[model samples]
Target: MADFDKPSSTEEEYFAREDIEKKRKLALQQADQLAAKQREDLRQLHFMKCPKCGMDLHTLKKGHVELDTCFNCKGVWLDAGELEQVLAQGSENNGKVMGAILNLFKRS
Candidate 1:
């Protein structure tokens, strides 16, 4: 014979639900925190300064394309589609591409 008993106490069931809810909330909060940290890291990487002229690199929009430029030397640095990369998935590879392009122009 099986004892067809409801939970021994409603309090225990209530506490169980509360514990589950708490864990769910904590997980959501942790995920939000992680996302925010990643965004901050990307922002730091995307916004750079020109070493030669001491001017902060500025992002500008020309028609539909985005460009990065230095205020002093009028040097334009392109991140090889950086705006799309960052906006899509927070990638930092754009900086490397920009550096390579600039170096190529410098060598010639």
Candidate 2:
């Protein structure tokens, strides 16, 4: 006569597999949370910092655009569409505004 109170081998295997799957899901969720936290930390560390010299950036307002200028590196950074706005405003006076701005640098 076999004992009916004991669990079968197949039932034990199913529970083991279920435990492993639950552990895997938990680890994946933890990894995703850690990755998100790392990204936010990096963003905070590099926010508004200059790419060239790793210095602070100042906002200079010109017309309708706010430019990010690094005084230490003397680098000016423009956000999306600001350059086009500037060029469009300048083009109202003459259509060759881009060419005129390009001509400011002497040919070497």
Candidate 3:
């Protein structure tokens, strides 16, 4: 049989080793969680296919929102309150016009 513990293994020494091991494990777990969150955020930012033209959809920044637009069909796709955020920015000369255009491409 092989002995794993050191020859001078005191109770305090064992507890100190356990504390270091626990801290290492917690750090690894927190790093993994952070990596997973970053991957999910990157996935959410990926471009999608245009429902109107089947072409690549591009993201356009409207205020704080990222709106998906199809350059091929000149169509825009809004997720939830993205349109409201865009309009609320008080953009001049093209915001209202773009909103009208987006409305024209709405499905049902």
Candidate 4:
């Protein structure tokens, strides 16, 4: 009768090593993808000086709304209702406000 117990020591070692290498490669690929995505997101965030006034146009958070304000011009810009979206993406409440502010220029 043919043996049907378990893999030999050498076979088990080879399979274990192969699995570890595969998992390592997958983790590296995931890390690279995450870094690339972060870079792209950062690049898309737009910043421009207020044309009407010299004051910088800065992001602000009031509740769930993200507004860009120019103190000198007394102007505010909203991202077409992106505040809620930013809030949804936040992992915690602490960063929700800041994340909403920074997401003003991020692409949907």
> Best lDDT goes to which candidate?
2
Candidate 4: residue 9 Cα off by (Å): 0.7
Across residues 1-108, which tens digit of lDDT does each residue of candidate 2 receive?
466988899999999999999999999999999999999999999999999999998887655657787877777777899898768856775646545544433355
Question: What would you estimate as the lDDT of candidate 3?
Answer: 0.76
Global lDDT for candidate 1?
A: 0.67
Q: Which stretches of candidate 2 lie over 4 Å from their true place?
A: 93-108
Clashing pairs in 2: none
Query: How does candidate 3 fare on TM-score?
Result: 0.40
Name the better of 3 and 4 by lDDT: 3
Instruction: Kindly give the stretch of ten consecutive residues in candidate 3 with the minimal lDDT sum.
Output: 1-10
**Tens digits of per-residue lDDT for model 1 on 9-103?**
77788999999999999999999999999999977865577656767977765434466777677677667776574344323454554454355
Off by over 4 Å in 4: 1-4, 46-108
Tens-digit per-residue lDDT, 8-93, candidate 3: 56877988999999999999999999999999887666548787777888887654778788878887788998767767754664
- In candidate 3, residue 51 scores what lDDT? 74
Q: TM-scores across all candidates?
A: 0.42, 0.78, 0.40, 0.41
Scanning candidate 4 in windows of ten residues, the lowest lDDT window is 99-108
Model 4, span 57-81: residue lDDT tens: 8877666655677766666565775
**If candidate 1 were superposed on the true structure by all CA atoms, what would the RMSD be?**
11.1
C-alpha lDDT of candidate 2 relative to the true structure:
0.79
lDDT of 3 at 5: 59
Task: Please give the RMSD of candidate 3 to the true structure.
Answer: 7.4
Candidate 2, residue 63: how far the Cα is off, in Å:
1.5
Give candidates' CA RMSD values in order.
11.1, 5.0, 7.4, 13.6
